[model samples]
Target: MEPRQTKLIIFTAKLIAFLCFAYLTLAFFPQYAHHLLLVIALALVVIGAGSLLKYKSQRNWIESEAKLLSSEEQEEEIAVSQYSKLKYYYPVIEYAYSANGISYTGHTLSHEKENLWVPEVNHWGDPTPATDRWWLWFEPGDHIPVYINPQDHSEAVLVKDMTKARRSHHLALLTGGILIGLIWLTLVVLNYTLPLR
Candidate 1:
């Protein structure tokens, strides 16, 4: 599939997250809770991640300059680094990555559109500027927060968890709405439809 399709899918998923969180948050803490807190929080989280990505990029640039001057290192050409560190800021660290059993894998930001090639972040040392087919193996970097289980680090994933915590919240909300409908049905049955006499 085209990369853009994946992006739209991810984005649509986020909107779902926002809507689910908003509806559930209100159902749980209602009245002013949804409009006041939940909606606002979701906006901040989504917006904050964008801002954080830019901020982190700038910060990295500044750090790079400082390092270039203050420290002496071997010659290695630097390329544009992909993805933002905002994931670390959010609650993603709680989930464990399944692929490598990592809570978080070093995100490799894709610059395919910009005609740039970046390698995965090298854990043993710094990453290589070298690029090839190995570069396109993983999905593009997600500025969205990612969560992974700690037990198995490889099981990490981009935000939008289908975990129990997220699911239970939805099911609990549905029960209340469903119960009212069930009660209405019972009353109608006794009133005329069933004619229990």
Candidate 2:
């Protein structure tokens, strides 16, 4: 499948999961709304903290022009318990960049953990041609954007869509946190307005 299609499917799945979670929490657990809201708010805050840490880590990485030295697809077998083996493809990339007249090599792509694996089989357990792997966006000799550590010039990474993803993650966490806060407030209002048993 194309990258756009895969992204759409992932987004749809996440939306469905969030909706189901919200529905289940609000429907059968109305009596525990306050506790649930508190838990959700804490979870969102933790996620936001994680994003903030990532952002801070990369904040000092200086952007520079780099040349793609090589790109290769390597396969690895992971044991999912003892009965099943999952094959995953990793795109190995090597790039070279120069900073302050010092030449350095790097292999990291980004800080975000990207889901680059696609099941080789369809939902029915039949073989499929789709091998979900990182599509190499830069070819050998291609000039691409790279982020290098100013302190350690050798440490570098190819610039993926990190900034955009970080922003979205932060926004999602903020929105979820605010929603939970409102839910808690509503519960409090109702508790005070309703007569005590």
Separate clash counts for every candidate: 19, 0
Q: Residue by residue across 23-97, what tens digits does model 2's lDDT show? A: 886688756545656667877878776766765787778889998899887665767678988765657788888
Question: Once model 1 is optimally superposed onto the true structure by TM-score, how far is the C-alpha of residue 76 displaced, in angstroms?
Answer: 35
Q: Against the true structure, whose TM-score is highest?
A: 2
User: What C-alpha root-mean-square deviation, in Å, does candidate 2 show against the real structure?
Assistant: 10.6
Q: Give the poorly placed runs of model 1, Cα more than 4 Å off.
A: 31-42, 45-56, 59-197
Off by over 4 Å in 2: 1-33, 48-60, 73-91, 100-103, 113-137, 141-143, 151-155, 160-170, 185-197
Tens-place lDDT digits, model 1, residues 1-197: 96557987999999888789777766875543424333444444454354334333332221100001111111223333664321101110122122332223423222112122223354445655344323222333312334333444343333222334433444454444455445445644555333323
TM-score of each model, paired residue for residue: 0.25, 0.46
| Displacement of the residue 65 alpha carbon in candidate 1, Å | 16
